[model samples]
Target: MSGETTNETWEEIVVRVLKANEVSLVTYVPDNVLSRLIRLIEADPFFTVVAPAREEEAVAIVTGAYMAGKRGIALMQTSGFATIVNALASLACPFQIPLLLMISERGTLGEFQQGQAIVCRTMRPVLQSLGIEHFAIQERAHVEFVVDGMVRQAFATQAPAALILSPLLTKRAA
Candidate 1:
């Protein structure tokens, strides 16, 4: 299924794409922006959801899971993403682990928090500097395609890929 139905939410589409890609392990650091996605992933028996104390830990967990012959993903908000830069650069990238990351975009579109806004601007540049493949999903219509393709390419190339969930898609913009 392409998950093109109007009734299917972006969160549901994400779960479906993850399952279709055989990504059975879900690691995350709790965040309000990603709560719905995490809840859906946890409720599904197909996924083994792990909530770590920090985003960096989630990255390490997914990397370890991948080493054990499992496909995994790390979900977190933009602020949490700031904590994982070192882990992503030193561990995931150098080790060639296809650590999947799903980040909820914040600090944009009338954001109230100055800290979030600052980090948001640096996110894309950091990803580019590290040569990590990243895509932003601003609309539900393109979620499945971008997610599936990123998953496939990440594993195939043995490199990490990021999926940024834009507020426009989540309907949380300002």
Candidate 2:
């Protein structure tokens, strides 16, 4: 076997990668695109999923979990990620927390919402300005390699890393 997934959806691939890496806590604000992954994470006893009213709360929740010696991942949309810029800068980055951010991309090509498109344009620069390393998981074929590698590196450096899920890769979610 090549260890490549065919029938498995990208969301499933994400769940598997997180589980394989022992990511126990998942914090997020509601995102329609991430609902599938959220549901899967919720079903597993190994994962403790938390939904906060706002994205910054999700950041705080994950930060607390990280300080307590638990691995956590924050899942949200691009707009949601924008909301956590301060938290990511003042808290996560300065603290050197190994946070895994899975942001579903918006405000890009084929995006329907004006707000989403606006945020999309700024997503990369926002991440760069904060010195956070981010990558796009824009193809299903690259999910395992890119996600597994990114997750490993985030923990290795004890820094925040993000995987931006492109609408191109997940039309259903988009």
Candidate 3:
């Protein structure tokens, strides 16, 4: 109770925080690691979930939704995050859209795919280069804090923010 989500799963905490923040639009490119989170968001009537063909398309969808006076979040895998750089740089950043990205971290220790690892390495650098605020949620206790704080910051400042869901947090590291 009172912002303490110690008993809930990370996905549940994410959905709770998102709802609490009034993020009504959920835009994402389907990702296996994020399936549970997406499903939870979809089941909730408060959210308008949209799956676009590509990660960049998801970003665009969120941007358009924000323009129309609705808050949105984009969910994707780390590799998919690599595909949205142009859209984020062009449409989201320059236009002052508060694009909230929830990326399922891939590539790194215990990872099997070389491409995922390659892209994972580049994600943080790209975010930093673009001056997009980002944070990784690796602990259950930290989930609500990071997600909620990032969401608040992005919308308050009209800037982009990312919440990277680490394999450790999702318990699907591979």
Among all candidates shown, the one with the greatest lDDT: 1
What TM-score does prediction 2 earn?
0.94
Summarize candidate 3's per-residue lDDT along 125-169 as a digit string, tens digits. 999999999988778888877888889989999999999988778
- Candidate 1 lDDT over 1-174, as tens digits, reads 644457888888888889999999999887787888888988899999888788888999999999999999999989888888899889999999999999999999879999999999989998999999999999888888899999999999999999998888886532
Model 2 bad stretches (over 4 Å) = 172-174
Q: Each model's number of backbone clashes?
A: 0, 2, 0
Instruction: Please provide TM-scores, in order, for all candidate models, with all chains considered together.
Output: 0.95, 0.94, 0.95
Best of the two (2, 3) by lDDT: 3
Number of the candidate with higher lDDT, 1 or 2: 1
User: Candidate 1's C-alpha lDDT?
Assistant: 0.90
| Candidate 3 or 2, higher TM-score | 3
Q: In candidate 2, what are the lDDT values of residues 74-142, reduced to their tens digit? A: 889988888888898899999999888889987887888898888788889989999999998778889
**Candidate 2: worst-modelled 10 consecutive residues by lDDT:** 165-174
Candidate 3 Cα errors over 4 Å, as ranges: 172-174
Query: In candidate 1, which residue ranges exceed 4 Å CA deviation?
Result: 172-174
Q: How accurate locally, in lDDT, is each candidate?
A: 0.90, 0.87, 0.88
